[model samples]
Target: MAKFFQKNKTIHDENKLEIVSDKSPFAYVEAYKTLRTNMNFLSRNSQYKKLLLTSSIPGEGKSSVSINLARVLAENGKRVLLIDCDMRKPMLHRYLRAQRFRSRGLSTVLSGNSTLEESIATFSDLQFDLMTAGPIPPNPTELLASAEMGNLLELLETRYDYIICDTPPVSLVTDAAILSEYCDGVLLVVRQKYATFQQVKRAKQNLQNVHAQILGCVLNQYDVSKNVRESAGSAYYHYQYGDTKLASDGMMQ
Candidate 1:
């Protein structure tokens, strides 16, 4: 059984937590701390409960962020549920290697054919739960925007401390924008060196148009390598923090 995340945990920087490996237990601890700090900031605006993790486009590591964020929340003595709301391209289940579960998950619940409780798969520790995108529906946007989706989220609000939805990229599909309406907050993940300014602007606009609480953007896969080019096509990735020069993309802002 997986152990539950305790409160006030801390981890060192540079420790990466792998979903499939039992190694890096300390990395998990550290990852939990980093995510918990982010969660604290997120809670300031939308409460610490329901959140949607989306990106401007696909293959941007948003699913990875969602998985780790939920695990961190679970570690903090909060019952966390990570829902794979990206019906078109469900990756949360694959990343978590979540066993003891079946497919036909959120799609079923959203279509009113099943209940949220029936689809939720509890982890070994009971602190972390997972709900996969069961069958891919033809019209994911319609299902996500329906009243049943709202009802399911409302039910989760009363039970879990955190409900994280891993939805499709906003620029790739309307699924994220649709699901964001039911969530309290939306965290957009923008990959460094990949996502364009136009796509990000459109994504932010899409969420804002729906009145979704934009919790701020997360710059994933941040690299400080001297050889790497900046998102704006600059060769230099250094920033002057006080007198010391820091080699990081300005995405941290």
Candidate 2:
């Protein structure tokens, strides 16, 4: 398991979203570099490459995290494929600016309306392939849990070194927990001031109930200045692995 904190100040602009790249802020880039290193260590130790990222609720930034994580991994020369598994609310295309292929993606492939190769969109700028959520489906849960979805993943694993799936919030629906069965690990994204402690706890419990391998949690949109002001002394956060206790404030101890 791996645990890390990321603080991003970039505001989401629907017309032009920002992702990690050479032109990004130094601190933002370095944070994702650290995340990449941590995930690499976990991958080597656990022998898993398929990772699923979900949050306790909407607006937690899991999709953005997934996109940047895949971008960083691809920057390291790995063959990465980022999939938009949130069929009900697909936004990867919009984030990556590949909305042109929004109509033909994972849903179309799983439903036999399109082939995987035909649905995949390649972003030359990002250097990784993307499979959008496709057109919104009536039964997203069923489509994700279908045998075809499993087979598609199996085929993709053979082609790519890493597969990052962005799923819906765990607390809002069972989609994340259900898709966890096909993934090797799960990363929970928690927005600092937005998501409640109880909501996070319930999300973790939901994944655990499905026996999902929780790689770790990412604290998103963390405000370093606010924490420094509140603590009056320390500006750093800490986390402990295995047997770690969750403090009442929802921090790992």
Candidate 3:
């Protein structure tokens, strides 16, 4: 069974508590912190603080990375707000084990059903905030692409240090590409052994077509044993877009 995430016995859902502060071992804690550190250099200006995290396809651990990154940021004393923009398949609420699910999220705020204050749920203990997917709506794409979404993001930048959003897959839906317009940059999460280079390349092109800034990529669940021995101790190819190349063990470097 996978360690980071597993299916819950009763809920039949998969949610992992691999956060650094409350749980996680030394390497996991240090890994998320290092990811936070690299992200710190993204921008000195808080105005440009929105970072959208997405993946090429489902089951690639984008939501996992987003929540973990948010936790690490909050641990560093930053007021982080993680919004589950993947209204179709919201998992942030599941990850937090929220008591219930209702119209208390981006959808409600976008549709004027509720105020932003009411939509946001504060993780009192975790020190970060979360905006769930709210009630599943029929027109998810329209709501995500509307001017209301842009306005909400702009308003959030004033209140949160970082607005990290977990969105739907780029190839699967237009939501990720559409939401990318409001974000400062987009981070692609690629699960090693699952996502192919071509799929990630297409995802990047999709983001680029939308004019979203490419922050880099996060290679998750990367096992170095097989490839490491094969390469005889060589640096992993972290990211290769066109001519640019930057490699790290796991976090975006």
> Which candidate wins on TM-score?
2
Residue 119 in candidate 3, Cα distance off native in Å: 0.8
Per-residue CA lDDT of model 3 for 28-102, tens digit only, reads: 566677788888865664345899998886667777678778988998999999898987867677667763645
Query: Model 2, residue 7: what's the lDDT?
Result: 36
lDDT of 1: 0.67
Give each model a TM-score: 0.75, 0.83, 0.82
**Native-vs-model 2 lDDT?**
0.76
Query: Per-residue lDDT for 87-118 in model 1, tens only?
Result: 77565555445433445488988787777667
* Alpha-carbon runs more than 4 Å astray in model 2: 1-16, 226-253
Candidate 2 per-residue lDDT, tens place, 1-253, comes to 0111223323244423446755565666766788899989987888678899998877666776787789889989988999999887677776555667787899999999988778887666567888989998999999989998888999999998899999988987899999999999999988788779999999999999999999988877655655442311111212222354221122110
Cα lDDT, all candidates: 0.67, 0.76, 0.73
Clashing pairs in 3: none
Off by over 4 Å in 1: 1-17, 20-22, 25-32, 44-48, 225-253
Candidate RMSDs in Å, in order, are 9.7, 9.2, 8.5
Clashing residue pairs in candidate 1 are 5-75, 11-30, 104-134, 105-134
Clashes of each: 4, 0, 0
* Displacement of the residue 79 alpha carbon in candidate 1, Å: 0.8
